[model samples]
Target chain A: MAERAQRKIPDSSRRSERSRRAIHEAALALIGEVGYAKTTIEGIAARAGVGKQTIYRWWPSKAAVLLEAFLDLTGEAAGAGEVGGEGESESEAYAIPDTGDLEADLKLVLRATVDQMNDPRFDVPSRALAAEGIVNLELGTEFVRKLLEPQLQLYVRRLTAAQATEAGGVRRGVDPRIALELLVGPVTHRWMLRTAPLTHEYTDAVVEYALYGLAPRP
Target chain B: MAERAQRKIPDSSRRSERSRRAIHEAALALIGEVGYAKTTIEGIAARAGVGKQTIYRWWPSKAAVLLEAFLDLTGEAAGAGEVGGEGESESEAYAIPDTGDLEADLKLVLRATVDQMNDPRFDVPSRALAAEGIVNLELGTEFVRKLLEPQLQLYVRRLTAAQATEAGGVRRGVDPRIALELLVGPVTHRWMLRTAPLTHEYTDAVVEYALYGLAPRP
Candidate 1:
């Protein structure tokens, strides 16, 4: 509708899509450069080469714009197969592969996650959002709901499949929701705190430790 | 030296100690209320009813002051035995008790940690520092090194004790540093992200899952 009011382009839909993508990239880049506190919708609009009205028409607030952009960035990484080569669509990008050999499959996905987290593109903007989220309850909840929870659910599905008595990975009574934390939490913590390096070797160890556990296996 | 120059009370040492305590309290309160950016030495001094010079004489920067005050607050909490009844001294406050059963000890301390993290006195200011630390690379590194790593080392010691042939807790060849992450990482993530409620039940579950792991036990 807005495009129709503007000068004619090659294709309205393609033009709209391009503008949408530019906004996402601009929002992420602005936040990463200036930090979340200073990032504004106007700055994003200026960077994206779009009018502020266009952003406002599409998204309600700067946070909405930034968070959606954040998710889209991760989606791009997923499409790049940074997390897994199988991802093609938005929904598909969120899904972890299940090869039935749960350990190998989980390891494969987690290593890819490590690679994604390590990518400066994802890491920079994410740190800005995460830092802001820690202090802002509403934004943090939205972040978890919109961005983090969806990805976690994919782990839930994969783990749930493994819980099948016939397939046999997770124990029957084990809750996938809680189980996913052990797999994901360590990596997230190390990345967030910079307490340790996020290496393939490190992620592989996390997977092994989480699968087998600390207690001596009898 | 400054105390000698000022009006002396019945006991100068007691007066100095009182001023020091007030400064710590003020620093924590100011940061928690106004956030790290707005918080300043003047603000802390004003709230504490001390000379700004006094604060500067003791600490080089507001961050240094705030972090030390944070450690003191936790020390006070440790003295209260919120984590373990055995705590008294500063070092003792950091130590995890060895009741021979590693799981019980870890769970006890973790439950205490959950309690501490939940305490508004600890939680509010911590959220500020944690948020700041996430974006500020130098501050984040100092936070992990000075505050978090010490607590983690206690776990390492406790787990190391368990790894003894006779004690038999954490399996041999399992790195304690990595193992500690599995236990601490989940609780930290949930707390930092505000993704879920921080309850004793949740932490107990974390301790259990971390000990046993995801794969179906043989």
Candidate 2:
């Protein structure tokens, strides 16, 4: 989380924004270099060239700092429209670009997601956080509620729209929430598990298979 | 894994089998209680009431011990046909009941998988190991190859069979390996990420959606 954004400080405080960005970058770099367990607030402060008290005043705990840093990184990514992470602007961040072609729109978004997950800056720290979340239930639930679920909701909105559209809309009785998973889940499994290479071809295959059933198409 | 199993020692040696089972139980119990990082070989030995050398002799590292222990637990579950884990008897363990219906067979197997994941004995330790694997790339890769991939292969073989069969076969051009992810990945995402309540209702929906495209029926 950008401190200024969260605190509702005026944009005039460029120095504070610089500090927040440095801290975010430091937290991410440190976590990526050393696993989540080893990351420390003091260490982050040192790395960011800020006093320890500065960090303490801003964030409550190391987890909070890391969580916010992650959110900020994703928010920046969303701001640039580089990948999957949505920004504070819900409408723009979550919009799925319904090009009147559901398949094409989904492919576009998912392909970008594949790129985002593969990006080193995002992948390394995200994996560390994700690893921690798996064992740490409280942290995991918070991560899901705050980060992952909101992103998934974007898909829900897009799918819901597709349901209403006449041009290749979803079939009756299909749940948008669950249908979105068929597309998202496979990519996530491959990326997280490292079971296979996550490539455009793979994402394309996933989108195709998800839109059309695996059994022979009648 | 199990040195005794590999050595083909006579089944008459009940003492050795007992010791191995004890160690496996201890490792799983310790990891589930304390998390993976705190779990040690000495701890496992003390808990099992066996000498430390016994564990070291059988497995090279804590990871190996936990891996094999998990394997044993799941194998036992598979032997009972309680869940998805395949037993030593590949044919029986891997077999998806070929009742001439592919969809039913997939659903039956996936539902069993949900049950296995939900089982406390499996869920707790498995989560710890999975958590460690996420950050530790080497460990994660090993876990996937030793534990996850083999189980996935069972799906691959079953799907291949479905492909060949004239009745309820998968459509041409669907890669069994990738197609299997559609079924397995969503459930894993839910189970691992704790996105929502994993239930038969959810698994059933997944199966229905995966087998039938989301697109409207003509």
Candidate with top TM-score is: 1
Off by over 4 Å in 2: A1-12, A82-92, B1-12, B82-92
Candidate 2 CAPRI grade:
medium
Model 1 chain A poorest 10 in a row by lDDT? A80-89
lDDT of 1 by residue, A179-208 (tens): 888989999999999998988888888888
Candidate with maximal DockQ: 1
Per-residue accuracy of model 2 over B66-178 as CA lDDT, tens digit each: 88898888777666653345444543354556777888888888888889999998999988888778777898999999888988888898888888866656887899899
Model 1 lDDT tens row, B1-218: 88777955478788889999999999989888878888999999999999999999989999899888988987876665535445464554557778788778888888988899999989999998988888889988997888888878888888888898665578888999999999899899999998788888788888888888778788
Query: Distance from true position, residue A106, model 1, in Å?
Result: 1.3
What's the residue-level lDDT of A53 in candidate 1?
A: 98
- Candidate 1, B214: how far from true, in Å? 1.7
* lDDT over C-alpha atoms for residue A172 of model 2: 73
- lDDT tens string, model 2, A83-172? 334344543454667777888888888888888999999999998888888878899999898888888888888888888877756887
